[model samples]
Target: MALHLYALAILMGAIMSIYIPMISQSARVMGAAVMGNVPFFFVAFVTSVVIALVSGQRGDSFRKIADVPPWLFLAGVMSAGIILGATFLVPRIGTGALFVLLVTGQILAGLAINQFGLLGVPAQPMTLSIAAGAVLVIAGAALVTFGAVT
Candidate 1:
């Protein structure tokens, strides 16, 4: 439980830090996209490798990748697309608005994923409360995006 809380705190800090440098992140992601994902992925892969090596928990996960479903591998592609898209959108929409829309999309996608029990997760039935929460999120996104307009 303590480790979970620590991880959650770190995640929250990371999220906050990302918004502070969103423009730089966007530019870097765009540059990476243009230059080819190999360099970008290589850097991130090496960083992960170093971290794993230092942590002393370097399991044989890579060796077992072939055993996992092929669709699981698409996460890398999806991550690249998301990074590129966020890079393009953040400048146009502003970080706060972009984050609102992104969070809304994430919640909706999560709801669907949970509903269908995708990726080997247990099925989590979506109740009316969940639907209502999703609706509220969309409404909040709209307000964040358009509220300033006359």
Candidate 2:
């Protein structure tokens, strides 16, 4: 099940890679990158509602919402900030550079998260192999962002 979820995450990542560029274009057309979130969240909200209803868990979900600590809600704020930043940066830095940097950042954060088991996630002590992989990813990001075009 974990492998299946990982595969799905990879697929979703690919879709998001394309989606951000489209959002950047839409932001260009709409005259503000932040404006892109209006339609984005509208669709997200509708889809989430439909999913909750379809799962017959809408009431349960709503009830459980209060069980969540207030700090957990910051995830939504972080998500909005990410989308808004991507919408703004994609146009200026190009998708390749932006995603390279984003992925690099994600890898670094994941390493720390796994290292300390932060946010209730299971701890995975950082190993030499993992550290090397991160170093390579950072190097690749540098190449993508700073390398000269031929």
lDDT of each: 0.74, 0.90
* Candidate 1: clashing residue pairs, number: 0
TM-score of 2: 0.91
Across 50-95, the per-residue lDDT of candidate 2 in tens digits comes to 9988888867788998999999999989988999999989877899
Error of 1 at 7 (Å): 7.6
Taking every candidate in turn, the Cα RMSD to the unseen true structure, in Å, is 3.6, 1.7
**Colliding residue pairs in candidate 2:** none
Query: What are the TM-scores, per candidate, against the unseen true structure?
Result: 0.75, 0.91
Candidate 1 positional error at 87, Å: 1.2
The sequence of per-residue lDDT tens digits that candidate 1 reaches over residues 1-150 is: 599999997799577548434544646666743344345567889999888778875468656667988878899888777666666665567777877877788888899899999878889999999999989999999999889989
TM-score of 1: 0.75
Q: Residue 143 of candidate 2: its Cα lDDT?
A: 99
Looking at candidate 1, the ten consecutive residues that score lowest on lDDT are 32-41
Where model 2 places Cα greater than 4 Å from the true spot, the runs are 1-3
Error of 1 at 83 (Å): 0.5
